[model samples]
Target: MGLDAFVYCRCWQDGLTPPAPVGPVGFDEEGYLSLVVSGGGYTETDAAFDGWTASACPHELMEQASEHLSNWTGHRLFQQALGAAGWSHFPALQAELPSANGGRMPAEAAVRVLDELDYFEQQAVIDDEVVLVDEATEAVALRYVAAYEGVLMLGPGYRAGVDPEGFFILDPDSDPPATLFRSARFRQRVLPSGQVQFSDEKKSVQIAMSPVGDKGTPPEWLRLEKQHQAPAEFGYIVEPLRRLCRAAVATGNPVMWC
Candidate 1:
């Protein structure tokens, strides 16, 4: 029901085998290594796609980057990069989209979010306390709190997206008081059913309330055993997808994110 990625490569011609999933959420550690870490799951071959190829090359690429990247890419450079990619599939993604990601293709919005990656960061809400160790990471988290001050992920949509963890990355001044609710203590909880619940219980009754994105909280990091430093903006998502695109170009294969 959620998004996953794959590489439709001719390399899978020999004997396509999708990385076996050990759990419903994802595959085992080794599967992640091949499917995502290296972005290479099959041996390269000169052979072309034939009657033997699997739709996904039996290996995944990304787990959903969310719709953030492409929608945020209303910026200049990302549009340029897509046009330059020489892949019409990418260029078409830049066209006016529908309701999913503010009139942008899911993939295209992903590109924009990741365009200014140097500014992105990743933080986690441990036990429901947005906790991050590094200076930059903490700064971004603090910025979202409005009580403190962040975003490469900043903009009109800033408040709607960031919680303690969503952006730990949007510029601090974007719309703080509204972005992170009223305080760091306002926790976002993930139930065993994998559903998210963000407590809007304000840190201060005096502070006015703003709406939160229904699916803003990152669904995966809820169980993080340790603080994960994704540093700066939405770059974490952008970089992986960019790599996939590069891989696609280099191998003349198709990039599949669904």
Candidate 2:
């Protein structure tokens, strides 16, 4: 089985845009000859969707009627509520959230976090530790540990929607502690069962993570793992990706956890 996807590209831009596709994350549009480098594998089609989104596109366009007219007060409240609802998704890092981040959160809270990004000012940084803060509430939403070379795929549920509306990216003050990047070292050992594992003694934990949207989305990277197992292999890569596509459509939500 294999994955099929369209890559978006934009012309006339320089450098990696904020939230650059350093890994398998998806983009919202597709074009050819992008001015910026898109992280995912690309096809020969003269199209790419990996770049900084423009105001003209529906994905980046903000509704003027959104309740966040003045500052990010309204949106901030929403983000906090959402974070609370999704708290269970982030493990080992939950307690570290409130003080280091914002505070302890419940899995089902109504607090919406960063619902409208326009109210918040944004900046770009490379290979640095950045903090995600809700400007209105002064809450630290999340932290990103980046590599000077590129980004690593972020955790699931960091992005939980099809519109790519609720995601935020933050760089850390320094490289993430050793435990974060530890997983990459073991990637070289692809086991016979196709399952991979990382060992603390053999790997450093300092990893770079980027929040990516749902799978099967148009512009994100769709990795085709087992090309020869499509029709007959029930548990093959093709069926799994197809299942992801169907799930995305049925839910009307991006497979945000991918």
Candidate 3:
């Protein structure tokens, strides 16, 4: 069996308790404004919840959205390009060129060329290499090799600031406002038996409204959307959840996943 994921928003009140796991529930387009259990339970039952609710988005949808969002929102365009070239998987390339230091030119030299040139300009230098497979794959491999070399230049902490959390938060009222989009806060919990769970405690959950396109959206995120050619192709999947978030925020309710 695969891991289950859920996304819902509940109204906030001073003494309200968290929603109990009554069983499986489905949310529709209008948002699950009222909680209804199949076994004939009152809307105010301890197990049921009030306020806006959206159908739970699939875990895979969240994962894909996060990946695309990262790629589009990140300022490191070169690194993104390198990733497209498969740099993380294959870092070395076979080429026939002499090194400036003396023997055959190593992968390091190819990387330097990549950093110094734009996409089109790098093609001239790459043309001299021995055919690795096909022209397209070889070109991508060469770029990856270059990216690896560039990372080496940054020293040990090149990746130190990378966010380990997997989800992005979108709070608009933050001090700087833009700070909300800076890092991911969603994290995975590892069980003693080595099983992994993608869930968070109520206290740890951060507040964020969905990026459903509005004037309230942060400028930085809007630019990313334009730059990446509307990278949020899967936005529809999260629309309901976004609506739920809006309702929760309006009612001062907390959103949680189980």
Using lDDT, give the best candidate's number. Answer: 1
Q: What tens-digit string does per-residue lDDT give for candidate 3 at 1-258?
A: 111112232222222333334533334233332333454645444333322121222323212111111221221332334344445332421121111112222223334323333232232211121111112122111011232221211222111112222222333344543333222222333345533233233323222222212223212111111112121322432233333334333444323221
Best by TM-score: 1
- What candidate 2 gets wrong by more than 4 Å, as runs, is 1-118, 122-186, 199-258
The per-candidate count of clashes, in order, stands at 26, 53, 5
> What does the lDDT come to for candidate 2?
0.26
RMSD of each: 16.1, 23.3, 25.0
Please report, in order, the local distance difference test score of every candidate based on alpha carbons: 0.33, 0.26, 0.27
TM-score of 1: 0.27
Ranking by TM-score: 1, 3, 2
Is candidate 1 or 3 superior in TM-score? 1
Stretch of 10 with least lDDT, candidate 2: 62-71
Residue pairs with clashing backbones, model 3: 11-253, 12-252, 12-253, 32-53, 111-146
RMSD of 3: 25.0
RMSD of 1: 16.1
Each candidate's TM vs. the true structure?
Answer: 0.27, 0.16, 0.18
Number of residue pairs clashing in candidate 1, backbone atoms closer than 3 angstroms, sequence gap of 3 or more or interchain: 26
